[model samples]
Target: MTIQQSYKITPIANLLGRSGSSHLLLGLLTVAPTGTLAISDLTGSIALDLQHAKPHVGKDAAWFCPGMIVLIDGVYEEDHNATTSGLGQTGGIGGTIGGKFIGFSIGGPPCERRNVTVGVSDGVKSENGDVTAGAGFGWVDFLGVGSERATGSKLRRTEQRLLGPDGAHTGTAKMVVCGEVNLDSPSTLEALHKMLRSYATDDADRMPMTVVLMGNFVTHAVMAGGNSGSGGSIEYKEYFNALASVLTEYPALLRRTTLVLVPGDKDPWASAFSAGASAVVPKKGVPDIFTSRVKRAFAEANREAGVKKSGVEGEAVFATNPARISLFGPAHEIVLFRDDISSRLRRTAIRFATLSHDLEQGEPVEADATMMSGGLGTDSSTRENTMDVDTPTPAPAAFPSAESADFETLMARKLVRTVLDQSHLSPFPLSTRPVHWDYASALQLYPLPTTLVLADAEAPAFAVTYEGCHVMNPGRLVREGRGNQIGWLEYDVVSKRGVVKEDML
Candidate 1:
């Protein structure tokens, strides 16, 4: 059912009275005591049959994990077999509803935008001030920038004054993000230097406000027992020292822009313990223990430039792997995550086989090898023959030209949808994508951010926009064999648009 439909979520306890009638319900999808799937809410639980259930959005199958909260549209049959137990058996919610719910369609709850949730807009506050300010989480500062209700309006006005087209400094609100920088690789450092110098040439007023450098700073697992890994944690510290040297050269850039360092799975601490294996989500940032030299470089640069507002003073921030950057409070939020999520998702993805649309339409259904490799291959032969049968429900203006989307483009679209629709960075089970239970809240994308910087070196570098949220990947900073060329992303915070850029030496 569409959002516009007027519907009430029938409580599980109330299901028995409305037997054989269709109704909508909101509950958690879980396994019952009998090992069968069930849905449960506070009132009680009922057995669920989703074998033939389709996603509410027919074009794409909504991801359904056991712990996910979902909306189900189905009919309740009181006479259906009770071999599958209901959730009431496992919890103290209530007695079993004694019915089977045959689902028609299922989907994630509709996402809320920042403006609506924060009451940041003049119109929103004027119309629903009492409700939004009191009920919404607008008073909580998720990123520690400032509470949305408290500073959202003031920051927004400042944002327009500084970033709006009619304002004075329009182009200065830009961010430069580089994907993977292996400090051990001289070429990568040289390429980064070139990128820095290129930006440093811009007038002071036109400089980017932030420069994000994501990691895997070393060429290989620093903790692995080998010649390369011999240095271990100490060697890892030296790599940052080398990077510090690079930053010292461009003191002007360091003094002007905020340097955000986001660690990768292969970065220290976690790497030292996990041996570069799949680390937990919301992993700690590169420990201050190693980033001291990098911090020193920033301090030296600041001292060279003299005192200024602490907010404008250039400083290096070692942010958590999955970090949120709030600019203009709730007006804009940028999420930075460095992981090969595209690869992990495909490895654990549920592959379903159904008749292709082409076959149903009596058209040729050609199977290409590229479709099997997670749509990363860009060979013309593969692109021409492969059909994007699995493309997510196309957005009205998101793709613009759906038929012409290549495998890489299709992959980007799939990645964006799966992450945003679920409203969680890691939607897979704990086994597939381990998340720190306590910090799991950090991974939630509720009221989705304005932009997501998914610096996945494994995923093809491409920018995709879905449902007003823009996701970009810089891919591998310097692909092997592609000498002296570096790929990165330039995002215009004012316009909320990103352009993939490459610098060639």
Candidate 2:
């Protein structure tokens, strides 16, 4: 009996991580083979794509070097032609005028070959023709973190692994992500009822290993009412009282599922929050605690109906808005932020193009397509559809003026890429968008994450893989009175790939 079972409890304050009955290994991520070789976060003209027939004696360096964060002292090849599209004016691109090498995109004034070589601050001079005239300014491999993990999240079919307990297979365990469960919308409320009812009847696969629900549960109406009830919307307290009945009716679902909720900025209970404006973790109590009234009411109603106490208190969670999910043994991590930071990013990010598509950092980025800089007047749907070059676009709004309160741009798919590339969630200057000065380190998204859920209402639902991380946005349950909508995210532990989709609730 020396092999007595032992389960490692994660430090997460709320989740099956601590409460599940079965002892389980936690935070386990499959690691790539380790070796010493040069690696860079760069792609364009300078990165030598070293591929060999049987792989060279030293080329066994497979994708993202894991668990290591290194520093590279090489020069940054400044994109000379990089020009921001100023509002109302069409600016010329500053990239190299070229004959087809990727040092830089073809642009700028044509000139005879001038300065053939350049010297670095280190007094290191380049050889003749080593630099692609204006195309590549500097290409050097400096020392960097040489962790032996792959660079991006796309898992080759051969690399898949299971994420649940030790005995679980790769295809068996799944995580459910949904957002904007506005309690005000009857349609949204009904959608939950239907979902629970269906699962109550489903004895086979009703329970997913975990479910995350992001919120604006109180909506603007409740907040404006000062919690007293406004615009004929029911008060916050009444809303939870009613939700109790729904949860009680589907007792089976209450028993099986672990529900985790994170609050959104617009959520009624969150209005008075003054901690960190851009921070995702809720400053108040956990989101599920709001539903405690429902549990209490359920118990009372059951006794009144001449029924036995269901003994179901609903194993629910109240977690920070941007809580962290850890799998220690696998070394896998997931960070969930429920607010719509995508909207803020579009407002202040320094940009090159209107991101036609989500950038897959692991693979080559397709760049031949022209990006139309839709100004402040842009809407989410317009940004989503702008990639279809053939689509006729209306004039983009005037360039945004930060000082002017009326100005705010809404860039679509590009927002996520900008955030990932910067390795920070709220990339705008702190003055532009302040984060909690004390907890700022909490938002540093370095080494990236195995999965990042950006549940936003301003952006469409999308799943994009960037720098060995999965970035997903599950929009909202209801938009503009149209209810019965849901966003879904599915991640396969073995492959490190996630599938994201949105549909009728």
Clash totals in order: 0, 37
Regions of model 1 farther than 4 Å from truth: 1-3, 11-25, 29-49, 55-66, 75-101, 120-141, 224-231, 308-312, 351-397, 480-485
* Candidate 1 weakest lDDT stretch, 10 residues: 368-377
Please list the residue runs of candidate 2 whose C-alpha ends up more than 4 Å from where it truly belongs after superposition: 1-172, 197-201, 204-206, 221-234, 273-282, 287-289, 294-314, 328-330, 350-413, 479-485, 492-495, 501-505
Report how far residue 101 has shifted in candidate 2, in Å. Answer: 27
For candidate 2, write residues 1-505 as lDDT tens digits: 0111222322111111122122111111112123222222221111111121111111111111112111211111223343533210122122211111111111111111111111112111234323223422223111121122232122222233434344256433456677777776677777667555544565534355566777766555344435424332236556666666667776555554556767766554545443224533334443444567755644444455433443333355656656777643214568888777655544432222212243466553333211222221233353333321212212122112222312112232344434554455554444455566666665666546667888878777666543235667767655445555554665555444566654575
Q: What is the lDDT of residue 332 in candidate 2?
A: 52
lDDT, candidates in the order shown: 0.71, 0.42
Clash pairs of candidate 1?
Answer: none
TM-score of each: 0.78, 0.50
